[model samples]
Target chain A: DAGVTQSPTHLIKTRGQQVTLRCSPKSGHDTVSWYQQALGQGPQFIFQYYEEEERQRGNFPDRFSGHQFPNYSSELNVNALLLGDSALYLCASSLGQGVNTEAFFGQGTRLTVV
Target chain B: AQSVAQPEDQVNVAEGNPLTVKCTYSVSGNPYLFWYVQYPNRGLQFLLKYITGDNLVKGSYGFEAEFNKSQTSFHLKKPSALVSDSALYFCAVRDMWKDTGRRALTFGSGTRLQVQP
Candidate 1:
């Protein structure tokens, strides 16, 4: 079974440009969450999608948004990207929104904003 | 709010010796804890989790973590270190009672482990 898969593996965009990152959750998972990991730092939660609706959101600004497809896939969109937005965008999947479920992660899309 | 802390920025150990990477967490109510390791350019790989039962949880790569409720710490340990084991280790936690915190895991800053020859 393939775990969570995200694409494109790496991306580069200029300031004020928008980019969309896609993710396909692991075959038996129903929930998808996005995280951003900057260099030398831990991942910060961006948002989560379940049942094709946004279930939860972190402290990110409105510039960041996401969507979950009916097929359990998800997409993360960042508008007017800032140089600070350059980081590894990670996608995690879990069976449900419960506390006991362990999340499986993707290799992540390394975004570089110039 | 829930949070995790890896006290050490880096841990160095000799190959073949026992290694420990410390992690402490803060959360209200029952806590669900996890440990993940990351290679150079890979995603965070789940090592183990502590949902309930067994303070000692054994996970992949012969890694085990001991959950101490009183200390609010979940430190990862390995009986013997290998050069290949050197990587970034992270500790994460979820508060079961929080309506919002349950949806995501809060991770620590990460500790780099270097197993020397």
Candidate 2:
């Protein structure tokens, strides 16, 4: 089966620009979550989407938002990007709820804000 | 709020020797713990999880984790390390905040394991 897939493996944008990153969950999965991993740091939770609605969000500002479609794919949007927004954007998919399910991750989109 | 901590920034082990990466967690309810490995330029790969049952959970690549409830710690262990095992390791937990419904996994800062041949 195909694993979680993300598009635009790498991108460079200027500060204050807006960017959107896309992700397709693994087959048979329903939930999509986004994370940001800066250099020399672990991935930070951004938000999670389920049932076409945002179920949870992390400490990020309003500039970070996301959407989940009926097809179970997702898009993460960042507006008014800052220099600190440069990081690897990761998408992970899980089949079900709670702590029992395992999440499969994508290779991630490397976002570079100049 | 639920959170996890990986105290070590890096762990160095020799091939054929045992290795251990430490982790501690905090949560209001029962904590569901997990371990993952990440190679350079790759995503985090699931290794194992502790939902319930035994205190010791075994996973891929002969890796296992010991969950200590009293200590609130879950430490990843391996009997024999290989050079290929050298990578970044992360510990995470499924967290649910009162504000965020089913926020999902919260990851640790990560520990770099270098297994020398």
Candidate 3:
């Protein structure tokens, strides 16, 4: 089966610009989560979407938001982006909202804010 | 709040030698732990997870992790390291109590493993 897929493998945007990254979760999965991975760092949770609603969010600012569709695809939006926003955006998918479930990740979208 | 810590920034080991990447976690309740490996310019690949059962959890690519509840640590181990096994390793956790309605993982800073041939 095709795993989680993310579009726009690489992107470049100027500071203050807005960016939207897309993700299609693995088949048979329903929950999608977004994370940010800076250079030389691990992935940081941004937020999680389940049942088309944001279920949980990390410590990130309001500038970061996301949406999940009926097809289990997701979109991560960042407004008023700063240079620090330049990082690899990872999309993960799981079967349910359970701690026992393991998340499958996408290749990630590398966003470069100039 | 739950958190994970991978104390080592990098781990160097020779091929055929055993390797260990340390990880510690903090959670208000039972911790669901996980280990992921990332290659250069790639996403996190799930290696293994510890939900319950035995302390030893075996995962992909000849890797295993030992969960020590008293120590609150989950350390990834490999019996014999291979050069191709070199990559960035991350430790993640979810607090069972905090995951009542939401499930978001708390990740460690990651540890780079370099297995020299």
* TM-score of every prediction relative to native: 0.97, 0.97, 0.97
Which pairs in model 1 have colliding backbones? none
Predictions in order: lDDT: 0.93, 0.92, 0.93
Clash count for candidate 2 is: 0
Residues B3-94 of candidate 1 have per-residue lDDT tens digits of 89899999999999999999999887787999999999999999999999999999998999999999999999999999999999999987
Show how many residue pairs clash in every candidate, following the order shown.
Answer: 0, 0, 0
Worst 10 residues of 3 chain B by lDDT: B94-103
Question: For this target, which candidate reaches the highest lDDT against the unseen true structure?
Answer: 3
Mark the regions of model 1 whose C-alpha exceeds 4 Å error after superposition.
Answer: B96-101
In the range B1-117, model 2's lDDT, one tens digit per residue, is: 578999999999999999999999998888899999999888889999999999999999999999999999999999999999999999999886766456478899999999999
lDDT of 3 by residue, A1-114 (tens): 999999999999999999999999999999999999999888898999989999888889999998999898999999999999999999999998877999999999999999
Off by over 4 Å in 2: B99-101
Instruction: Give stretches of model 3 more than 4 Å off.
Output: B96-101
| lDDT by residue for model 2 (A1-114), tens | 899999999999999999999999999999999999999888898988889989888889999999999999999999999999999999999976666998889999999999
Give a tens-digit lDDT track for model 3, residues B4-117. 999999999999999999999998878899999999988999999999999999999999999999999999999999999999999999755344555678899999999999
